[model samples]
Target: MGKKKASSHKFLALAAAAAIAVPAVSPAAVSAKEHSFKDVPARYTEAVAYLTNNGITKGLSPSQFGTNVSISRVDAAIQLAAALGIDPQGTYKNAGFKDVPKRGQWAVNALAEKGIISGKAAGLFGAYDAITRNETARLISLAYKLTIDETVKKTPFTDVNAQWAKYVDALVKSGVTEGKTSSRFGADDHLQRGEWALFLYRLAHPAAKELDLTIMHTNDTHAHIENAARKVTAIKEVRKAKPNNVLLDAGDVFSGTLYFNEYLGQADLNFMNLVGYDAMTFGNHEFDLGTKPLANFIAKAKFPFVSANVNFTSDENIKGLVTGGIAAAPKDGSVYDAIIKEVDGEKVGIFGLTTAETVDISSPGAGVMFEDYLEKSKKTVASLEKQGVNKIIALTHIGFKDGGGDNDVTLAKEVEGIDIIVGGHSHDLLKEPVLDTTGKEPTVIVQANEYNKYLGTLDVKFDKNGKVIGHAGKLIEIDAKGEDGTYILEDDPEAAEILATEYKPAIDAKKKTVVGKTAVALNGERADVRTKETNLGNLITDGMLEKAKTINKEAVIAVQNGGGIRASINEGDITLDEVLTVMPFGNALAIMNLTGAEIRAALENSVKEVPGQFGGFLQVSGLKFTYDSSKPVGERVKTVEVKKENGYVPLVDTESYVVATNTFTAKGGDGYSTFGKAYEEGRVSEPGFVDWEMFRDYIQANPNAAPELENRITDINQP
Candidate 1:
């Protein structure tokens, strides 16, 4: 058993190191012993050899390699700039730091010009201080444009506080470090010799593409790594089966869970680094921890972050991080505007679009504002087309439909020239790619299911002129069947030994702690909710009305946005996990008073069902209404009745009633403009009851309750 354990430890460490997608070094070119000079420590022999062979770092003396000596800030800058192939002689006037000396200052100036470093103070370069492991990790990450993958398992860590959180985020996403064990990363602790060596190896030899690429991406993970293990295994299987694929995620990866609240984002980052990602975009959530931490994460990522929309004007810290190269705008009248890639000997153009809504929802401290996606997309795509690139792909965070009763299908549809759209936001799990046939050429649009539950696989065959020859794709679900159940999770052998010592106790501690049970499986499938009202919707609406009346007896009508219902409750025992899944977003209950006439108008407005439209109608409880598709828009809703304590009563035009609904609807979501005019007269007694909690209580109180489609509200004369 000890031998097997030792073997497992060795295998895990080696696999973790090997999994790093750094640039490869030729084995036959040079060996470690040859690069070790007289004064160099034995441990740095490999690093020195690799660095020297690649012309990244030169030895201090013919017979001496300064391995143990600390790297000064100035020298560190020079060495890193050299490694990135920045010219030593260049204009240094605009580099920003005040104290950099005229002589031997080119490296610092070049790096600063490229936005890779900042001074200890305004003009002072603290050149003499020995660089820490964290600092080193950050600088190397920036030079190489490394982004962390979104797959690895999350573990808790101590010492990496809020200030250094983003660095931890990038490191994990880049596959740079896992925690010390399953529960701790010890981020502030000095990195070991073996760890540094592996870091350097990854820096030098990034991952290679074995086949065509299918990138599954997510942004704003917010510490929800519940499906991370499954996501990782699915990505690997996809990669193995179709060697030319990549997995990508945009930013906002930290802050939103008990885990993030516990360790900030350090543990989350560590796990992401272990999984490996190809690229990412910067979302505002990355700034939740602040600028320094954001910079640190930027430095530790193993993949490049693309942000053409955000401008980091005068801030020295942000400027230093963003100076690598500005991504070009997409060509005119084309989808991707300015994407760059080599696909089958053809140049494929790709640009990215973030939501305009991010300005309102993102934390204000992010210090950034989104540009208009439609305008940017339009201008960029036209430019890319003028540059002679035809195949375009837009990596967008803008939602599918503008939920405002607006038919705008994002910038992808508004603009005429995009070839493909890879989308995020609205978390819509597009089961198949939708092709827009309105244009002269078809535009293929696709999105994967959110929370990393599934990866979107898109296969597009393009001709010489960048025209699509064929396209096919699907959302591949990541389930138990795709997982191998083998994971490394730790680096310390002694800790592993101790964990082995108490393995049984730990296993027993983790034996499924039941939080709650469901009598039936709640269905929250997007299709079922957006297209038709389900049993789950009825149950949830009932909960809203019931909760509202507890505070005010007059609360009669309950309304909910279809989007708020996230999952379906299947018949059987439901776990707490299932409950959380059903109500992922923590929304609050709101009650309002409306006259019977106003209620009828709001009901009529919400029932206009249009084909191919999502999030239009309001699901209700305690009220029944019907509409006729054959009737005109204004005359759709015909009859309405409310369930009184005694029995059913025809809704009186003059009677005032209390109504219950979510805050989303209260603010007029899904184009229910009539709701915007409805006045909120009085505050209800209670306000903080969670919608799902109410649903659970309702289920417990009445076990035999099931949804009945009674035509309480309906369409006019046509029916």
Candidate 2:
């Protein structure tokens, strides 16, 4: 900001050109002593009217407002100095330059003292030198106190990078100036009086400039497009009322219900495009369909996608999207690290971070690697800072779990300068925002649970320094009334059309088919199923155990992968589509013969990523186990017992046991390689029943079946 140059002649030419092209409506061009002025019919009538009506500028004489003449440098300075209420009646000893006319010496010295302009050369004030566009930008920017660091790789102009980039970038960022052409600044151009008046008028009224950012966010939507219409309506309404409103999704808008099974992620993306999402990050399930499908989805996105980590080099499908560059040197048009968004005169930088666990529980396919979330996050923030962006946001799928590592909480604490985090993956229900002040400033984190039941609304207020000093966040229920008991969400007519014609047809036919009835609300939610025993988990595993018993009566225990259970079912007549939605993978039931020791090892593997939830966690039936997550991997399973004829019995290492699980896990999905080895040894048998079929059978046989935790699984280490 204090940069000094030995010569100002070249810059003066550029500044003069700018001043002439970018006109302001004022009579300053006709000389204060001249009388009649011409009424130029241009777009600046309102500004010129304001100047005349407010006495801010009187015509060069009585009638002429000098509407169409070249404005002199001294006239522009005098107008700006007067608007700022600076008393320029006193004489200055240096007079800013030797050439400053006696009548203008006070205004020139006053403006120079405020750093708005400088002499063209030693002792040469150049007060009469025509002001250029670049000069007008510099002076007005300084008047508004617009600060600039750097956010350009190359100047917008082919000829401007070396000398005029800083001034041009500042003026654009300030909302007071733009290049003569999209790719050229027209630096060596002079200012007409009209152009200079407009600049002066804007500088005079700095209060009109401001930014109010309203963010509508969702996370882990998981193909819950049924309620999407209402959410779309809500977003459109907010946008109608605000200027800088942005719509964002934290991730997992892919799998869960029959919607995803029948149409994959198409339904969600289509709806997202309809709602105009500004950006999105990758959720673990994004890789469940392999990198090719994920790339296809990304290609269809209308907006940019960001993720600081996750190497796309290993997969040919997504390699083209990875515009290779280091994290600190953000590449133009690349969404890998961070993106600078201009929102109503303010620059908001957004970056993304994915969960590292995608490697363990998700089938991202070969050639994909995840980088350290925290490390990449820090680098991205630093890069954004280098780009002159102070308001930074992290769009992450890394969740927020209490007492857990690598979650959003850790991110807020580790990465400084991040203003907010819109997150998902753990499917957390944050009715309000959680503010963490562990860093140099407060970091607000918000996640709107899972599904499309609600839209998260966050309003943040920043001081002039771009520091967030006030914020408010809330969940706006899509179909429910507001706290004041009035419905705030309306159904979008356009969204309804899309849902009926484009997105809902594939699953509509099966969505109504009944499977079985549930007495209690089955809980297969990602956050609960991965960390504890959910009734939905119990119900699914019960079906697997029943089927295994038919195969061998000796099959005493059953276990289902938590990842296989995708959604919860309300207490009612569950439909076949609902069953498929809860268990969408179409995994076949596979029975495995394992010794007690192998079973114990598999159970240990289940809880390996505990406390911080993992999809590999097992939901069991006909068996109960207690574990301490604080213990080492092999030692976490402190005790295990199998249900016997008389009662529960402690596992015997040499005892042969029959267990049931999905084919994917039996083939080592979710790090269950123990079962994989058993399958490879030909000790695993296919039960010939689809997983969802069992879910249907279990609910039919035990109508209104409400399975309880029953102390089947315990975390002894938990406080």
> What's the C-alpha lDDT at position 29 in model 2?
38
Show where candidate 1 strays beyond 4 Å: 1-213, 218-222, 250-256, 263-268, 283-297, 314-319, 324-339, 343-346, 382-388, 404-408, 480-719
Whole-structure CA lDDT of model 1: 0.56
Candidate 2 lDDT over residue span 455-571, tens digit each: 899998865445678888888888798799875676788888888887677677867887678778889899989988888888788889997787567889999888888899999
TM-score of each: 0.45, 0.52
TM-score of 2: 0.52
RMSD of each: 19.8, 18.8
Q: Residue 179: error of model 1 in Å?
A: 56
By lDDT, the best candidate is 2
- Tens-digit lDDT track for model 1 on 549-573? 7756778989877777777766765
TM-score (C-alpha) between model 1 and the true structure: 0.45
Model 1 weakest lDDT span, ten residues long = 1-10
Best of the candidates, TM-score: 2
